[model samples]
Target: MSPELSFSGLSVLVARVAPHTVATVHALLRDGARVTVASSLDDLPTSLRDLAERGLVTLDPRADPTAHDVVLRGDPSTSPAPQPQPRVAPGSPDVGTVTLLGGGLGDPGLLTVAGIEAIRVADVIVHDRLAPLSALRHARDDVQVVDVGKIPRGDFTPQERINEILVEHALAGRNVLRLKGGDNFVFGRGGEEAEACTAHGIPVVVIPGLSSSIAAPALAGIPVTHRTLVQGFTVVSGHVPPGDPRSTLDWGAIARSRTTIVVLMGVATLGAIAETLVAEGLPATTPAAVVADAGLPSMRTARAALGEIDATARREGLGAPAVVVIGEVAALDVLR
Candidate 1:
């Protein structure tokens, strides 16, 4: 909804049906533009199919994108391979730069001003599933927005392929933005991406975000620490169960730490985590809480003692991309 902007006479071609792509198509249609979505029928979700059925959009995989007034590269895999570029001489002006931006807790409002500026100036944006796609409204109509988000236990873009996409776009003289949810370095694999960019001689910048580890619980009115109850906090990954060989966490030390405990990406294994912590000497009656879909209108919170928190969350139908808090603070809703 920009002032004095209209697409009444334009036809737009969107190359794929990604989450961000769908948002863009809707925006164009709202502006009175005719839109054609190009992708296989199998990739068309019910919403897109509804649009096609109503004759509001033309859905064709073989549509000639050149026929449209505007063509969007919605998915990197669907974009043409970047052609070779003339190498820049040493110490010469760098052609393109990459900005690593964190989206923060699934809310566009949580996205920092610097992050939005980066998006507005980017020629290509490579984003993750948890990142705020709504913020892409700030991007140019022609900016190539690629969805490389990884869904837990589901289809995802390989990290290797994502790295290649960043490098390819930078080498092609396009300013690239690698956007994700939460702080880039907090279990975000941002270090690896930064390293890749440095190795390839691409100038890279990182703008930190509010990590959901702290934000989610706060939004749910549960503080991770309180001066009288806990002096510090420990953030852990619950993606792997306690007994899994892949897990290097010392559940014993964590349980004995006697500090606020915040677990991220641990919803699926909360039962095992609680059991291990209690067996390792933590009190079974310790207060625990789960905040799901943080920073969203549908966000829900579930709370129980350490011994029953997992079942409580399950009974409440709460799921992942959640923050699990265990400590005295979980029993207090300071905001309430």
Candidate 2:
């Protein structure tokens, strides 16, 4: 294919290749980049041998293990051949499909293999504020990104509007991906989206994401459940206060159960929830931890007794998009 955009000054080197990544390389060739294809960067052409030393480019030049699945794009003297793509099935017209992908906890690298595939093929992506940003960089340049992120008390997008966007795009024969933070069904309102798609006769596909309730704590070195200590665990949404009539959680049962308690979206009501648990028989000395930005560089964790967790959270200024663990496991800091 002829070059559409010129990467005239750019130099690209691809190493340890995979068959699927070849298409991206072909794209680079079409863009007019001076690309060098080698099994390893160590064996670069004599002219570009010092490329690594010049420090012109490096996503992470430190030490990329000689083996990885990333496909890099570049160009050469001749146009690169396009890789073969799957054929469209006969009689099955290409209809609009909505894929709900889990963006993982905070770290972009945590996105699942299937989630990456969905992003690469999507025509439009409607993402949440907490969605893994690193995963979005792999999307094709032409892909449309729609921000429908809902912050706690800040800018918010109504759910109906999000559903409308998905349905409207699918009706137009475009593949839309609703990328969300954590598992789509784990308080993600994914079921409602599926229902909307089904009501409108649109095909909906859901891809599970890593929920913060479990992954966040683990990233902060506190497992929600332990082999010998915790036989089971319970995850609850803490958006409502214990005394609120609108709340449906059974605090009494939760306090009586032996399972670990993992709360999502409960930062605001932590104090009331903790007090209720203690009133309902949950010990005040139970171990607890509040972990924010679980897998990111700024990740912070504050651990204390259940009676003190609310204060610890206040002192640390920990905010939402965090995982709260209360039980014997939160006391353990094995990950450090």
Candidate 3:
């Protein structure tokens, strides 16, 4: 007979093994396995009864038997061992290192105090296209600024090469600031760069800034979530893999979900995304909005139905660094 078990935070499966199955389970438990028997009080195996008598396992009668044959619940008190800290080399110059700082969503005023401070203290600033040039005015005149903008399908410094530059400048006793457009950790590949620094025994610090993902939409007067419109929201990366066989996203779930959908770096694949949503049962008339160059003086916004997004974006010339908002909340903007 199958038995189901439930405990604080564990799950276990058991089938008709043998009469001594309970003893085997008990041995496994003593060796640090948390087990629970979910069958009725009268249906427990003899081995389970023995373990229960010894207080090693608990028996609960309220579990479903058909769905789960046997259920073992683990103890929640135990946790894994802590990891050791990385060792730093002796006499390494701590003065020269890299700080990956986030430049907030194209607005110099949006920059945090710490971000401005980093700019003032940096000896060299390695920046991207998204970072506003006005923000750099705070830096010293002698501070070297290197533009490493990665244009799509254009001349660009590879990520590995960028990491090498940061390290080389730091080892040369120069305080380097790796200025990024938005939050470094959010789809910015900052983690990979941080790992590279760690592997080379170079110290790195991260300063997070406002990501354009939400700020861009907000600057365009579009709230990602509204209590009357959307109860929750989901942010996704629109950069799907080339020739990706497996579905990169579950469009059906997103379409059916009553939550706001925000897509970052999705302008190029806008048509495909709209089609996927429509095909997955989202209405073609669903409200959607796109904000381009958000938080900048040249910021432009376009609102349309799901079916009209692709054509509208093309006609309006809305391109990269744009934020896409999809859901009922987008429709409310018309009233505002």
The positional error of residue 51 in candidate 1, measured at the CA in angstroms, is 18
| Residue pairs with backbone atoms closer than 3 Å in model 1 (clashes) | none
Which residues of candidate 3, in runs, are more than 4 Å off? 1-91, 241-247, 334-336
Residue 262 lDDT, candidate 1, scale 0-100? 95
Top candidate, metric TM-score: 1
| Candidate 2 lDDT for residue 136 | 59
Question: Sorted on lDDT, highest at the top, how do the candidates line up?
Answer: 1, 2, 3
For candidate 2, write residues 1-336 as lDDT tens digits. 233545554665564333222333434433445445554445432212222222222323333444433324333213233322343332235558899998877566788899999988988888776776546556765666676777676556799999999887777677899998898999999999999988877888988998888898888777777898998899999999898999999999999899999999998999999999999999999999888767654468888999999999989888775778999999898866
Model 3, position 137: C-alpha lDDT score = 54
Q: Which sections of candidate 1 miss by over 4 Å?
A: 1-94
Candidate with maximal lDDT:
1
Is 2 or 3 the stronger prediction by TM-score? Answer: 2
Native-to-model Cα distance after best TM-score fit, residue 263 in candidate 3, in Å? 0.9
**TM-score: the better of candidates 1 and 3:** 1
Question: In model 2, where is the ten-residue run with the lowest total lDDT?
Answer: 46-55
Can you write out model 3's per-residue Cα lDDT over 249-331, one digit (the tens) per residue? 77778878878888888888888888888888888999998888776555788989999997999899888768888888776
Clashes of 1: 0
